[model samples]
Target: MNALLFIVCVIIWGSTWIGITFQVGHVEPVVAVAWRFSIAVVCIGLWMLATRRSFRMPAHMHVKALSVGLILYTLDYSFLYAAQQYIVSALLAVLSSSVIYFTVLFRRVFLNKPLRREVLVGATLGLLGIVLIFSPEFTQMTAQQGLVLGLLFALVSFVSAAIGNILSENMLDEGVPVMQMNFYAMGYGLFFMYGYGFMSGASFTYPDHLEFTLALLYLALFGSVLAFGAYMKLLQRIGSDKSTYVVLVYPIVALGLSTLFEGYQWTLAAVFGVILVLIGNAIAMGKLNRQLKIS
Candidate 1:
């Protein structure tokens, strides 16, 4: 179940970048985000009803869910979108790798998990791999005044995501079912997204193209609903500190997809990056250590 959920999350989220590309040009980013979660909330609510699952929770759980919504869904994405406005895509991708380390940091601080040496080593290799994968883009990045601000926003996004991961894990430890928590968290997320859209006077620019609408549905169903569901469950099965390594695999999948669809030419550096990422994953999963002992 753990491996299955992890694979589901990595593949779903990896494919989401394609869906995200289709989401643009017709809607404001935040509004699109709002729409995604709104659709997810409706679908999840229906699923809960159809499955006869209880939706009731304590008042404090509602608060916790709302907090997760604000930090994870709202602030995390808000910062990422804003950062992209000022920075290059390659830089943004590289900076986002900080999520793994931030997850480690939060787990130690909040959950009091001992900082394992392998986790840091694996995270470092994963980050280096991502940097290698985007070496060309990184080389071309210009040092503008907004670069610092963009980097800051990206870090904020990473931290927000880390907080969200830890919060979900903590909730699961408290006996909240993954689907139930996700249902409420997504509900609150939709609520905040709508609130932000209204307060910011974001215009509702609905997609007229069939492809765009299809992509939006895919995101809401696969990305928001299924992917998040699998991811949070993975978090519960394996502590957030380790499960957060999914970020490391995200870019490798993106690059492979790009090769097929975007005509991305794989350089030697990129191949090496793929190797490093795989090595990092092995380290993270403790496969290398186990194999050594078995031999």
Candidate 2:
């Protein structure tokens, strides 16, 4: 069941970048993200009501959840979309995979948990893979100030995401159920995102084609609803450290889809990078076997 959920998340989230790309010309990124969450909130709320699930959260934790969601969903995604305007989508995708390293660092500093050596090694290899994937983009960054700014924003997005993960994991530890927490968090995130869009004078524009609307629906339902819900559930069940291996696989899936639909060229560097990423994840998870001898 967990493996199935993990694969579902990878596939849905892998496709989310394509859907988001489709949304770019119609509405401002912030506005699109706000709409996505608004739709998801309504759908999830209805489901909770129909299923007779409790919506109550402890009064004290409400603020925390809202803050995390604002940082994670609202700000992180906003920066990511904006960054895409300046950077290649493939480069952005690779940089986003660095979230696992940030997750480990944040866990150590804020939570006082010791970083595992295996996680550090995995993070190093994963970062190297990202560097190789985005080598051309890095050269562009040195030439263009806007590109540099975009990279900075992307890093900020990763930091906020790590903060959100830490906060969510802590909340889970405090006995907050994933569904209830997501309900409140997403509601708050939507509110903040919409508020920001309005304050920024972003006009909500709609595309004339049914394809755009269908893409939005896919992001709201499959990406936001099913993927996020499944991921949070997995975090609760397997713990955040193990659950985060999903990040390692997501880019591979995204790259594969790009190859199929976007005619991305297969290269030796990419293949080698993928091998390192997979091996690194395996090592991090302690799945590598060691020989033992008994006297």
Candidate 3:
């Protein structure tokens, strides 16, 4: 069940990068994100109603949802959509994979979990792989203003997402139902996006392009709702530390799509990096340790 969830999440999220790229030109990124969550919230709300899931949440859980919405939906995705304007989707995807490290680090700091050696090693290798995959883009960094800022924004987005994941894990620990939590969180996220848009003077124009509309629907339905549902479930099954191994595979699928549709070329460095990332995920998951019977 966990494996199936992981694969579904990886595949869905991988495709989201392309959807996100398509989302770029038609509307303000913030508003687009806001709309995405708005649609997602409606879907989740309907699903909850159909299944008779109560919308009642404790005050603290409501607070948790607010914070998670601000960071994860509003800030993280706001940065991500902005970053895509400055970089290729594949590069952004590669950089965003750093979330694995942040998730583990926050898990230790906030939850008082001990840092495992395998996780550390795996994070290092996986990060190195991401860098190698985008090493070619880095070489031209000096020439491209967007590249540098895009990288920075991607990092910020990663940190925001990691924080959100930790908070969600905490909420789950408190026995909040996943769909209910997400519905509320996404509602708050939409609110924050609108607030940010109002404050920043970003136009809340609705996109008319069929491509943009379809992409937005896809992002809302699959990326936000379905992918998150699978991922949160995985987090429940495996814990946040291991659940984040999804990041290890996101780049492979994102880069593959980028190469096909976005004209990304694979270099030897990127090939080597992918190999290292796979090895790192294996180690981080303790598959290698179990095989060796290491303590």
Candidate 4:
């Protein structure tokens, strides 16, 4: 079940980059984010109501859940969308993978948990692999001020994502069910997105294009709801240190899909990158040592 959840998140979230591509031209990204979470929140809320799951929570828990949603769904996504305007998604994918290390560092700071050496080493290799995989894209880039802004946005987005991951673990530890927490958090995230949109004077430009609408729905349902649900469940089973290695993996999937649909040519470096990421995952999961002993 844990492995299944991890794979679900990896594939679904990886594919979501395509959906986000559609979201770019239709509306201001802030408005698009608002729409995405609003759809997720409503759909999830209706499901809970129909299934007779209680929405009632202690006031303090609601606050906690909302804050998690705000950071994870709102701030992380807001900055993430903004970053893409300045940099290619390949670069963003590589940058966002830093969430693994961020989560590791934050866990030690917030939970006072000893750092896991295996996870860090694995993450390091995975990060290196990603850079290699995207080396062609990186070399094609010319330096500009917008690149700096993109990097800054990506950093903030990833940090917010790492914080959200830890907070979700803490929330799960508090005994809130995963779906319910997701429901509330998405709800709060939608609120924040909407509030930010208005405050920033972002006009809510709704595109009537079928592709845009389809992409938005996909992002709301599969990307936000299904992927996130699976991910949070995986986080419960594996520690964040290990679970977030999915970040390294999902981008590979993204590139693979791009190869099919967008004619992305894979280089030899990309092949090595994939191998390293797989080996890193094995090391992190302790599979490498076991296999070595068996051999």
TM-score of each predicted structure versus truth: 0.93, 0.90, 0.91, 0.95
Best by TM-score: 4
Q: What are the runs in model 2 whose C-alpha is more than 4 Å off?
A: 132-145, 289-295
Off by over 4 Å in 1: 143-146, 290-295
Query: What lDDT does the true structure give each of the candidates?
Result: 0.84, 0.79, 0.85, 0.86
In candidate 4, position 275 carries an lDDT of 96
Instruction: Write one digit per residue (lDDT tens) for candidate 1, span 1-295.
Output: 9888888988888888787777655777788888888899899899999999999998888899998999998888767766766777677777777888888888899988877667777778888888899998777767877888888888888999999998888889899998899889988887788888889898986767998888889999999899999998888887898888898888778887889998999889989988898888778877775654421
49-163: candidate 4 lDDT, tens digit per residue? 9999988788998988888989988889989988888888668878877898899999899977778778887888898999999999888878766888889988989999999
Prediction 2 TM-score vs. true: 0.90
What lDDT score goes with residue 194 in model 2? Answer: 84
- Residue 90, candidate 4: alpha-carbon lDDT: 66
Predicted candidate 3 versus true structure: per-residue lDDT over 2-67, tens digit per residue: 878988998898888778877887778899999899999999999998999899999989999999
Predict model 4's lDDT versus the native: 0.86
lDDT of 1: 0.84
Colliding residue pairs in candidate 1:
none
* RMSD vs true structure, all candidates: 2.2, 3.0, 2.1, 2.1
Ranking by TM-score: 4, 1, 3, 2
lDDT for predicted candidate 2 compared with the true structure: 0.79
